[model samples]
Target: MKTVKTHITQLLHAMNMGIFEKEHPIALSLLSAISGESIFFLGPPGVAKSLIARRLKLAFDQSTAFEYLMSRFSTPDEIFGPVSISKLKDEDKYERIIEGYLPSATIVFLDEIWKAGPSIQNSLLTVINEKVYRNGQYTIQLPLKGLIAASNELPAQGEGLEALWDRFLIRYFIGNIEQEFAFDQMIASVNDMEAEIPTGLSITEKQYIDWRTQISQIKIHYTVFELIHSIKRQIEKYNIQKEEVPHSTLYISDRRWKKIVSLLRTSAFLNETDTIRFSDCTLLLHCLWNEIEQIPIIEQMVSSALDECISHYLCGERTLEQKLSSIREDMKSEHSLRETKDPALQIVDTFYHQIERYPVAGNLLIFASDYQSLQKDTQKLFYVQRDKYRPVNWILKVYDHVRNRNISQSAIVSLKKGTRSVFINNQEYPLACNAGYDIAYPQEASLLFEFRFQEVIDLYHNRESE
Candidate 1:
């Protein structure tokens, strides 16, 4: 297992070395291939989309590859090879040679595939979905390991291309390299600097067969299952909301989602692990989104899902933090305070609703109830100088609810014993309630708020029902 993982990982590394800024497309292409799935690249012309697809065959080491550029007029005969004249005339049955077409190839790339007319598109749907192609009298089992498809634009509504579009499991949007990578690549091009293309590391046909069979037996970590369900629920909630995102309803077919487990197993296999890592869920960013705009939304969601897991912790998510910080700045401004309106009320309410709307388990709820409480008090203060909204002790209560929703069972046990924390990479991490600063920091009553956490916990249990 380790040997297989090492070879595959090295092959991925080699593929990445050539592409200037396409780490994700290269990785997903490799993973989709290993899992016997198809991936589609959505981007404009001349973005190395075709280049990445062409270079993928190197990972399989001299595997037979078929590449084609499809157009609006491209025919099935062009892709599947010509029909055998002898079979039609002699046997009176229809059949194509399919010798050098998709069925015989291990790795395939179809550029501008969205341009393919209905005949080719319909034929491809079956070939990609089931690895089987129909030819008049018989269904031929395809040797197709993986396919990488590209389009300058997505499918239009009148084309009847929805079924074929949904068949590609991983929809990745690619573009020109970022400024940093662009400069580097330009320098390399001028100097003719190139990395040696090594091709020895590989997953052979026999190894692929054996490993794929073994992958079915790999136990899925419960966290991975939980993540998948959470994502589905999140998408459901998003679609139901009032916001109008273009093509808001994402339709992942039953077949595609079922096969996702195999993709997860393949991801775990590459890491040489029996259990799926929280990091493995990152690929969901690529797998779930069918639209170009949904990329950012999915990226944040996948990151948030992984963050709250037992294995990973989010220090802060950048974009939301910046938004929060901006809101904070405006709320505290002197000019804003002098006004009759309570700006904090609206801001805090928005944050409160957002927290409830997309509540991620295990993430330290960045906007606390205290923040909400402060805003409430601020509202009272503005009404009259005598009005006060001093926040009292709610730390223990907040901690309890947070721990229930957030902490793993094992870590909760550590908290009960007052283990304080276990160190990771030189930082002391609290097993349960975040110690000192988180509980203590700058509250209206700091000292009292800091202590009595254990007492509160103890008295609540012992005095009533310990």
Candidate 2:
């Protein structure tokens, strides 16, 4: 078993190296191949979707395995075999069956699969689902252990072929790589020019048969049984759209999902684990996430289902949610001060206008002293420049306030004129508005009034909460 697993892993590495990058899809294909079952990869052109399938057949080096790139011109005879000519001549039913294209091959790659006409596809349904073909009066069981089909187009609506889509238990989507890989991909392609296929690393026929036998014997967990039910429930809750209700849903058919878990267990057994562990669920999630619906739903399922298990394996604790909440709370508080500082700003405006109209009026500083005193002080009557343009920053600084907690009340002081600088909460604030050091240092007057207003509001809110 260890030697077989090692050989399979090595074959996977060779198959993966054939593609320039796309390591994730290559890994998925390797897992799908481990089941020794048919897989259909649905992706756009030029993504090396078909190449992965071809590589699998090459890995086995089975000469009897046949591959066909299906086209509009392909007929039923092209796939299942022509009506047996001997029976037609003799009017004997048995000799009339001639094995078609698909039935004759042990491993097949059906390219552009959907383009095959309805009748041809109808013929494939039994061949794929049951591994048997019917022609005339004969039903021929095939040696077909794996069939990897590729299609550029997705399964269509009302095409009346749900059965066909469901047979392809493992479906993969291949997308373009990011911009950073652009130049690296170019260099890799140039180097791969005229690359020859290497041989030696492979899965033997006996090993393949044994793996398939093991796949059948693998016992599924009851928790996984319930988990699959929950998955179906979630899918229904979201009203997810699909080409069909996959056969796995209705037919009690086991999925590549189940097979993947089996393989992970097999891998662990080879590594000498007496019981299959939660880490196997990690690979199960990876395989299922790709084959399932859109990305958001897939991510939510994986995170909710297996994140805890994976975290325990990697870190031994459940801190993902706690860390996220801490970061979120910090962000919310940083921005909450913006919500509270609106009122402080209105008082600042009133002070500016008061300074402009009345300059030093005795107790009012320059309005009382006279026009001469105002002119002597500065050209602008009462300009007050704040050091910080952000009103919330100034409010927080002056109040000496920390979020979610209160500070002791400081006695409110009236704004007083001073040519020397004034300090609020020990930070020197230079006044530069028209009320600069003239009309009671208008900024200080504004802040003191605003502080009293906020104190009253905060008291009411805190009291209400209590």
Candidate 3:
């Protein structure tokens, strides 16, 4: 597995040196090939899509590749081969000369493939989907390791191209580089250095077969399977939701989902792990999205799920480093909050400052005339709104009465008619609308995590001393 990983990595590095900003598409292409599935390059010309495909072919030793650019006028003879004149005349049977065309090749690249006519499209569907090439009375099995198709754009709906489009399984957009450094490096690269095949690192046909057998036996982690199937259900549900709006939905087949597991296994195998890890789940962001807009949404959801798994592991572990790291992050956040201005705190400070300077402060005002004046003054000064000062005035009166009478008070908060009310001694006082709202950071997980973390630290220290 290490050898395979190293050889493929070197091939990608070599290819990407000349091709700027194509790392993702290049990686996806190799993975598609490793899983023995087709992938498509969807973008405008001059993006090194063909270069990446050729580099993939070079990863294997002596793999014959057939590369062609298709067009509306292209025929079967151009893609398959010309008729076998000798066989037709002698045996009176029609067959294509398959020595140098797609049938004879191990790695195939078809550019502008959607422009092919009916004959080419039908034959290609059979060759790619079934791995069988039909010629006259003979149906020959293909030795194709992978097929890479490229187009400037996706096909129109009425063109009857959905089946072919779906067979690619993995689709990637190859775009030109916009970064200054990468573009400059690509342009400055020497034009004469020939690509080395890394013969020593390359795996033979037997080794390739052995790798596939290993992937077949690779054990997928339970969480990995659950994540994939859950996404599949989401795809189905979203398709139903799109019935009214008519947008692109996730339309992956069960066969494709099964094949996706092979890619994950390949990833784990390369990482020298027996079971798939949460890191392997990141690849689903590439596999699950059918449209470019769906890319960020899927990526974010997958990242969140992966982070949840990581937090669970960290919370369970006895590592001093994880604890220190979490504590350090908390300190940084606290420091930021301490320095940043807060609107709620400003409001609270202003409210206390204004209310404390009242002339009636320190006076209970139990007399009828004084009580009326206090009510009118507090209502005008601290009213929550122009027409809704009754609740605010009552709350103030309750506070003054509680303080002056020296009575013990307990508050039970409840919501009444969408307004929060605090009950004290069976008396309900509506809280100010702005006073009851505050934000909570659930990520802190309260003090429970601290107790668990301390226990883990104590256990580790005891183990070490013993």
Candidate 4:
């Protein structure tokens, strides 16, 4: 399993070479291909939508690809292939040649797919859903690994397009490069846009077949099932809230949910995990939204759910509240856990630790809440100066060694519990105990409690970083 994961991960990395801002789409498309599902790309022209499909073909060894631009005037013969006149005339039977068309290809890409004629659309429904093509008298099973469709505009409503639209399990929106540096590199590069995947890394037909069997064996954890149900309820609530706008309502079928779970399972299998994790739920952002406007909303919902789930899981069998309660119980049991009553200066009614090594006018003060926030990322904190042993109104400036300037009033800071250091503007300073400060600096029991509380934070960070 580890070797398979390494191969797939390296293959995906190789496939993403020379591309800009299309990594997510390319990864999802490759995943869909391996899962035996189809994906739809919605974006304007020249956003590398077709290029993604082309690159996907390179992932498979000896795989053939068929690409065509569809229009209302297109007929089945252009897409499915021309009919064999000899068979029609000699035997009075009908069947397509099926030799260089979509049915015979390993990967297929259709551009402007919404404009395809009804005849082509009707045939495509069966091809995408069942992986079989009916060419009059014969139903040939297609060798299709994945079918990728792209369009600048969505299908017209009430035009019998709903059924076909529902067939795509993954719908993604691609846009131009947003980063200035990447965009500059994109326009100035002389390298070929089509990346040449390493031949040794290309997936073989037998390996592909075996992967499908192994993918099904991957387990879906109960937390994943619970998250799905929670997301469904959130969707229902959203529909109720937006009942006035019929188009705003999100309608997902049971079949689509089943397919989504299969995709999650495949992701877990490829990532070398035995069960689905909270990180896999992030993929739902692409699968659940029906309209472009709903994308951000769905993303926020999924992100919030993931955060709560991570917090719960990291705290172990007990909830965060329970864990904190146990910690407080331990604190109460220890008689030496007492606050110092020395006359130390304070700011904003909060006790602060003074810094003499760094040139700062004020005593550095960090609220407990703000200190906890540093476990995730760096934060900017306000420091105030004292006047005649009293808190002053004006915020004091602090020297930022990283930027080589004095940042007015606030310092970018992070906490390093292992070293007992506080990073100010990326410069580390040892946090030493002052003689007369409250909450005895770096008490063994207090540090032990803090470590127990935050040991799982690294797990959450590692998963997200991956």
For model 1, name the residue pairs that clash: 461-466
- RMSD after CA superposition, every candidate: 16.4, 21.9, 18.4, 17.2
What is the alpha-carbon lDDT for the whole of candidate 1? 0.63
lDDT accuracy of residue 5 in candidate 2: 56
Indicate whether candidate 3 or candidate 4 has the larger lDDT: 4
| lDDT for residue 2 in candidate 2, whole number 0-100 | 46
Query: Which stretch of 10 consecutive residues in model 4 shows the poorest summed lDDT?
Result: 395-404
lDDT string, candidate 1, 1-466, tens digits: 3487777767777777756777778888988998889999988987878778766777675588999999878888989988999989999878899888877898999998888888888889889989999887888898888899998888886568888888888888887877886657755774433334464566677888888887777776656765776677677777777257556667667777788777888888877888666767777787787667778878876776665544322221332355455546756766644433112121222222111221123222212222222321121110001102323211112233331354443232111111222222223333223223232223232112212233233323322221
TM-score of 1: 0.64
| Total clashes for model 4 | 0
Task: Report the number of backbone clashes for model 3.
Answer: 0
Instruction: Residues 72-174, candidate 4: write the lDDT tens digits.
Output: 8999999999999999999998988989999999999999999998888999999998999998898999999999999998777779998899889999999
Candidate 3 has an lDDT of 0.63
Report lDDT (CA) for all predictions.
0.63, 0.51, 0.63, 0.74
Residue 211 error, candidate 2, Å: 2.1
For candidate 4, give the lDDT: 0.74
Candidate 3: segments with Cα more than 4 A from true spot = 15-17, 189-193, 304-466
List the candidates' TM-scores in order.
Answer: 0.64, 0.55, 0.64, 0.67
Better of 1 and 2 by TM-score: 1
Better of 1 and 4 by lDDT: 4
Question: What's the TM for model 4?
Answer: 0.67
